[model samples]
Target chain A: MKKNLMAVLVGVLLTLLSLSLIEVYYRAFVPPKAEVFAFVPSTPVEVPEARLSAELISQIQGDPIMKWRSLGSAYEGEYNAKVVDVSKQGPLGCCVLQGFFAPPGKVHSRAYTKHRDLLYDVHFTFDQRSRRITPEVSHARNALLAFGDSYTLGEGVNDEESFPYVLGTYRASTQVYNLGLMGGSANQTLYEVTKLPEKRLPDLPDQEVTAIYTFMVDHLERLICRSLCLTAQGMWRLNQPFYSLKNGRPYFEGAFSDRKVLNSFYTWFHQSAIVQGTGMVLPPQFTQEHFDFFATMMVEIRDVLKTKYPKLKFYVVMYPGSSDPYGSDLTAACKKRGLNVLNYASVDITGLAQKRERIAGEGHPSPIAHMILARLLNRDLPQ
Target chain B: MLLQEFWDFMRERKKYWMMPIIISLLALGFLILFSQTAVLPFVYTLF
Candidate 1:
């Protein structure tokens, strides 16, 4: 009986080992189909090379996102033209390109790039020397501060195609500073805003920044939680107490280690899953905290901006997601704070829904969503 | 006498049960890593 049992155990172990080997083999040897939702090139189409010129090269470099390409090779293609070294935007360095294919006469389909098989569509357009905000967007106004993650930063989309750029196009007079960094959480947004110089306020015309719009959605919860863990670990790494809260809540106060961990984890997770899929899941109850942090951050931003330009308008543009419930949470939060919240969920973004397959998989909004959002903001802005 | 023999038999066989658990955990870890880094990237390229 003892001998029989030993034989069975050995057999089971061999079987498991065999299975692991098979899995690795399959993954390494077999090239699976390209993920439909991620950015994989379709059939290579052709376009005229002459369409790209020194003038166009100069124009592309002017946008903050596209400017990094100035240091590397820019090649034209028959279908999708490629621009290398767009910048170190994410996990792997990003590449920018423009594809000339569009739905029958809709002009060129704006070209963009993706890293780790993620697709970002670039649709923003700029004139020669990309530095000058298009004449249409150079209006005099209180500063426009846009804050959010990849979506707000226009990941998978072109610099011109990002909603912020689109929105800027509508309001030609205002200086729209694109502070939307990818993988940013609400806390990071607050941290960044806190660091801005106070002396820059007096230069504005209205003596008040018109609006500070911070884009937010459910993903903020997971990012915040990861940020907290990273903060704790960093303190431990530095031989310091991570931190203890007054109310017995785990909060990181002031320690540089705490901040470093938060920043690192924020970057790590942002690249891992938060930016890859529909974002990390949060329990239903924690949804309120998500909205609250966003609100609190907005208030803090308002106070800081007000100190410099005492009469600035603060707006929170609730970002849309596949699972977002039509901005109900944002409306409630804004109502409580007496703030103006843009109801982008009400806008007709049906075109984006139709092209959803070309965009991010199952539920991510596509470039059409950005366009629809831009149109909504354009309509809402004081004409 | 038969009951006494059975108890001794059970005691001898006890170590074998742990073998399956260890094998299963190793399998699970390998599977997770393979799925995340290898399988997913290959699949991403196809679509």
Candidate 2:
């Protein structure tokens, strides 16, 4: 017994001594060499062929070449979205607070892409309260609400070149509302659906509304990811909302909601690179439970919208990555709900970039791709 | 000498089973402290 006790203490001592050596070495070397990181030049992020085409399209359409905008009555003003001040906000504060904000003003500029003769003037506008991109023409009924992330919001393009604008202009009377939020998720979109018009959602039973949801791969991960927000500037934070499944139903959970103590611990844990790299203390993969929660949420969203618009035409446009397994899961879930889905998995828009890979050749369906979708959607609309 | 005596004390007192866990925790703490500054970015590449 005495010998055994001695062995354990010695073992602990040896372990501590070894760890001390490592700590000393790291303390001496790692901090000084922090900036000189080894680069592998490979990105784990893989956009599906269709998604890449979409990105290329988005990029090309944003090209400041040969496009012009007539600043009209629809122009409200230029709104700076970067003023959300990340330095002052907490996790939950960051989540809902950045939802929608429209300041007055219009930005009309004649800009051109790098070394391209594509000169275009873009006039950007937004509703003061809802931040909804006010259309050049607003219609009361037959409202088409385009909801999604940056793709629907036209992240890199002008307001005139956005998909919602193109689709709305497909017919003189089509009233399309651009409700795309940058860095937004299905969770955010669901929140938008819950609070339409002037907060608390529109409850007109007689109003015919068509809500189109654009599906992206990261939307699911973002839905349940608490504190997993990776900003455009590439900063990771222990903030953002998450949705968890309970009793076969998935509900949105605000950041650090119901887990103040756990949040405290994980927030500290995230600051450690070794722990994060181990992947043990981080978010688990998309499990069976997550898939179920995802499917459940879609039903719940539709159920919520159904309360107001019983005659709601809710459609989902699935633009999934080629190798993404979640696309199939989404299709299966949408099918189970008997929802109408337009799949662009087979549409290879990358090849379309081969000709003017410089012009309208690449990224999130270019303006031309938006035009194509507009025409396709027009064919589906009852003429 | 200290390590040897400590081992002898542990043997006498019969506390040999808790060795692995203690060492692992110690290693993790040190590793985390050291690796924090460098690997902050590129977290998206992992998850």
Candidate 3:
């Protein structure tokens, strides 16, 4: 009987061991798709396609070159023929720029950058020209400065379709400068504003730069702690040629320490399939510090910009993420500091769809959400 | 006589029963830690 019991125990143990191995293998190999992360590019290339019709290619080639705004694609042909770096196209293949071709009326443009890959697509005429916000008009009308992460820079959206661009289009008289950069947190936002040139300050009509919009999501809260995770040894080999350790850890030597890169890499890794699939939830303990830092930064930015452009209006556009319970708390805190708070809950986003077919998924506010914000800002700005 | 002998054998092995109790306590500690640190915050945010 004892021998039989021992056999049963061994069988159970073997089954459990096999199950654990399978779970680990599945996570490592066939992990679920990352929902919110964008692709990072490995190299940069520019390609011109002659395969398109002579008329279309001519239009593209002839269009006066606009200042290059980082890495993005443009479309020219009927069916919206997309022009992108041939090498930067994703594993699923590059978009056929031809499908989006239509006479420009109210074109919807979206831009996204992942790793080193950048995608910009223009969707045609979902609204009228009056509904569109042009930068020229915005400059003519109000003193506008946009602050945020990559989304404010129109990541996964087109330069013209970016919120700043849209705001510019909406208010032809407003002067808008997009001080947004990818991977920027609230502290970085404050730093960027303080670093802006004085020459740029005089272009605004109001000595009080009437609007300062800061975009934020929960991910910003993770930056400091993650930075602490980088090790001294890891810092040494950040930018050198990539090498794998015996345990299969990949290392690259770069200007930044290994710990910095490792922190970002691990953060990105955890933020990818497993954590995102479960809905990008962060620990609550971080909420107070996150809100406090963000609020402090906003106040500092407001005071600094106010020193130069004293009449500056300040607002925070809460990036869409359901992960922070302190969301309401943050809004209330912002109110205490005399800043306008645009929480997702306050907006009429009911009309906005959540899928790719209608709106960008994850925490990204849909185009409709953008419209709501634009309208609110237009109405709220002190005349 | 056989029943009395079996009772005597059971009494000899009482110390072995403490092993399962120790494991249960360890598992309860883990459960409490996970609940407070990760699970509660997630639930609070969702609604």
Candidate 4:
């Protein structure tokens, strides 16, 4: 018994020693490259808590139930162009409701390179529901639900510049809800659409409703919280929904924060030498299974909407040439499952390569692009 | 160090049957340490 105990203790110590050595080697020899810290400016720190206005705190505290729902605490009601980034950009423009994340919501920002050269300056606005503000059209007969990431939200553009706004005004009888969120993936769309009917879904008297989900290739990376996505989104994204597919159905496994052990391990792995030294990704490479799972999730979104609105028209629009590697595969999968897919890969919108089509420095579609998309959508949307 | 002590202990005790278990554990440690892709998902299933 004594010999066995000694052997077990030796074994345990050796295992621990091996792990420690590996950790030390990574920490000491494989330091992250300097370029790895490249020039991505984080959101500026909010005013100190001691100096925070009571109203701002109460409003920006975020939703208790949704947990990951609200924007940061620094955002205030009414625009102050100098408020966004006092040093370079002017404050935000007027009117930010109690929604959306800080920095990204209802602010005018000036982008600059490492040497502080001006890039692009623009404003954003959100409604009380945190949804991006799509200007209301008088006597709207139908409803338009626009979903996706920053592109759908009109990240680099103003209130009247989003495709949803143009789409809304085009029909003049459509109530548009811009449900796009920056950094959103299908997970956000699934979550929002799933909970929308349960919450205060907008009442529309129209006989038909059209929902457009703009698919960019990177959106898939965001769904799985790929290393690049996690790195880009930073700390603010921890509590956001993380989903996995189970038995051909997308399952909400809760936010990353909810899984403590995995979160800690993942956090460590992200910062570890194995990734930094080898420049290797931590998440498994996305595969056909993931695309199939995404298609099922889209189908689930369609089912939820169809159950709620009998005359729902759901469309997944893949931007021309943007959804590479798996775009056609996903489109085929969605069509096989009876979802309408519009692939813009072969459709050319003029001035796409020009600075006019993209936000300088930021790369989000400019208002021109949104208008073009709106026009194309208007032409294609079933009457 | 500890590995030497472990090997010495195992040999001294003639508990060579434990060798495979020790090797397996060291191999797992390396996998966790160097694995660029997700290993946590598999590890999570164990819990």
Query: Which one is best on lDDT?
Result: 4
Model 1 agreement with the true structure over A322-347: per-residue lDDT tens digits: 21342566556655777777644433
Worst 10 residues of 3 chain A by lDDT: A91-100
Ranking, lDDT, top scorer first: 4, 2, 1, 3
- Which window of 10 residues has the lowest lDDT sum in candidate 1 chain A? A93-102
Per-residue lDDT tens digits for candidate 2, residues A112-218, read 33344333333456554444363555555567777776567654356767768877766676567777765556667666665454552433457677877777655
Candidate 4 — which residues are off by over 4 angstroms? A1-110, A196-200, A227-236, A346-351, B1-47
Per-candidate count of clashing residue pairs (backbone under 3 Å):
31, 46, 67, 14
TM-score of chain A in every predicted structure: 0.52, 0.65, 0.51, 0.69
What DockQ class does candidate 2 belong to?
incorrect
- Taking the tens digit of each residue's C-alpha lDDT, what string does model 3 give over A1-383? 56545544565566556545655665677644222222211121111122224563333233232222222122111121223222243211211211111222443443333332324454322122111223554225456777664455443444455566656655655666655444344544444455443422344545446655555433333223332122221121122122222232212222223345555765554434333223322232455555655566667667777777766777776543322334466776677778777654322223222222112222233343344344445544554
Stretches off by above 4 angstroms in model 1 are A1-143, A198-208, A226-287, A321-323, A346-353, A357-365, B1-47
- Whole-model lDDT, candidate 3? 0.41
lDDT of 4 by residue, A1-383 (tens): 78766666676677667657876897888765321211111221111123334553343232131131122221112221112443332222211111133343466655444455544456677665666777687766678888777678776566777788877776767788887765566877787777554432465554588887888766565566555333322433454577787777878887745667766666676676655555455454667776777788888888888877888999988754445445677787888889898766333332232324555433556666676667667767774
Return whichever of 2 and 3 wins on lDDT. Answer: 2
The prediction achieving the highest TM-score against the true structure is 4
User: Each model's DockQ?
Assistant: 0.07, 0.11, 0.04, 0.07
Off by over 4 Å in 3: A1-134, A137-141, A196-206, A222-285, A320-326, A346-350, A353-366, B1-47
lDDT of 2: 0.50
Candidate 3's residue-wise lDDT over B1-47, tens digit each? 86466446544654333333334444534532432111111100111
